[model samples]
Target: MNPVTAYRFITANQFAVVGASTDRSKYGNRVLRWYQAHELPVIPVNHKEATVESVPAIASIEEIDDPANAAISIITPPKVTLGVLKKAKELGIQKIWLQPGAEDKAVLDYAREAGLDIIAGGPCILVQGPSLLTHRANL
Candidate 1:
């Protein structure tokens, strides 16, 4: 639940938003916009869509060229979140940020077992991300 981890997670070579949606009312869209608004290198992960927020979307985590060098923010159902974690683990993507509804006992347990650098049961990135950026600006 460390905010520092969230900061480090996004400060990666690339950032992906899993379940990034076209629906503006959803948390998925909101989270994706957070990254975009901050002007970070971001890719949207949405299997059913060709693009999200005008950015080309990848179907899965494995589609990224360098999984080990990226961080992901997930906004899927708890069960689907577990599957995403499994894929991420198999691909060596360690930095994982599970948005509030994306985590459950099973998902957290697997993430723990997989030795993932995870942020769960903490503040959503939307809440802390701006402050973190402000801190970086001040630095």
Candidate 2:
């Protein structure tokens, strides 16, 4: 899909950062920050109870109360992405932003097979996010 379409999908949803970490140095953390800065409702998904950037860090996708119109921003290891995708499917999430390095061809195929609408490997969230903001401002 085009960047505009992808941005619309993200901004219109209750977004979740699935691979969000407690570590400040990771891209997941940066994504969480970007979402927060944009005033997006972003749930940080991590195994740790510790909060990241002041957002409550959830341990799993199943824990989210409102999965309706939820989009998951995935930035986890490739090995773990399938499990996340599976959980997303189970929870009825449709949109997913699979960060670069978070998935391989197999994972991509799997996501497609699972019928998830995904945005992957084109631009990082930091770039797409700002571009989206600009697009909205111009409108």
Candidate 3:
């Protein structure tokens, strides 16, 4: 999807960052921290970790109370990401942003077939997020 549409889609929904990490240098941690820094509401989704970036991590997308209203930003490996996409589809999540290195042809194809509004092919949230602030404030 276009960056503008993707940005709007994310800001319009409840956001979540999957693949969160305790390590400060990882992309997962950076994504989580970015949302916090922007003062945006975002949950960290991590099965391995109990807490990430100081917030309790959700074990799965199934754990989100309102899956239909949420958008997930995936920063995991391609294998893990494919699995999360399947689960997210089952949970009624229609929007997803697969960060660089977390997406591959199979996953992209699956997401397309599922009719999800996806932001993939390298538009990182770390860059797009700040721009959304002005858009969000107008909402």
The better-scoring model by lDDT among 1 and 2 is 1
Give Cα-based local distance difference scores for all models.
0.89, 0.80, 0.84
List the candidates' TM-scores in order: 0.92, 0.87, 0.92
Write the residue-wise lDDT of candidate 3 on 1-139 in tens digits.
5866575565655778998888999999999998888787789998888888788889998898888888888999999999999998889887788888999889989888988778899668898767667777777
**Candidate achieving the largest lDDT:** 1
Q: Which stretches in model 1 have alpha-carbon errors above 4 Å?
A: 134-139
The regions of model 3 sitting more than 4 angstroms off are: none
lDDT of candidate 2 at residue 54, scale 0 to 100: 77
Q: Give one digit per residue, the lDDT tens place, for model 1 in 23-89.
A: 9999999999999988888999999999999999999998998998899999999999999999998
TM-score of 3: 0.92
Cα displacement (angstroms), candidate 1, residue 96, comes to 0.8
Q: Model 2: per-residue lDDT, tens digit, 1-139?
A: 4665486566555888888877789898888888898887889999876687877788998888777567788998888998898888888877788888899987898987987778886787787677566654543
- Candidate 2: minimum summed lDDT over ten consecutive residues — where? 130-139
lDDT of 1 at 1: 63
Write the candidate numbers in order of decreasing TM-score: 1, 3, 2
User: Model 3 misses residue 1 by how many Å?
Assistant: 4.0
Cα lDDT of model 2 overall?
A: 0.80
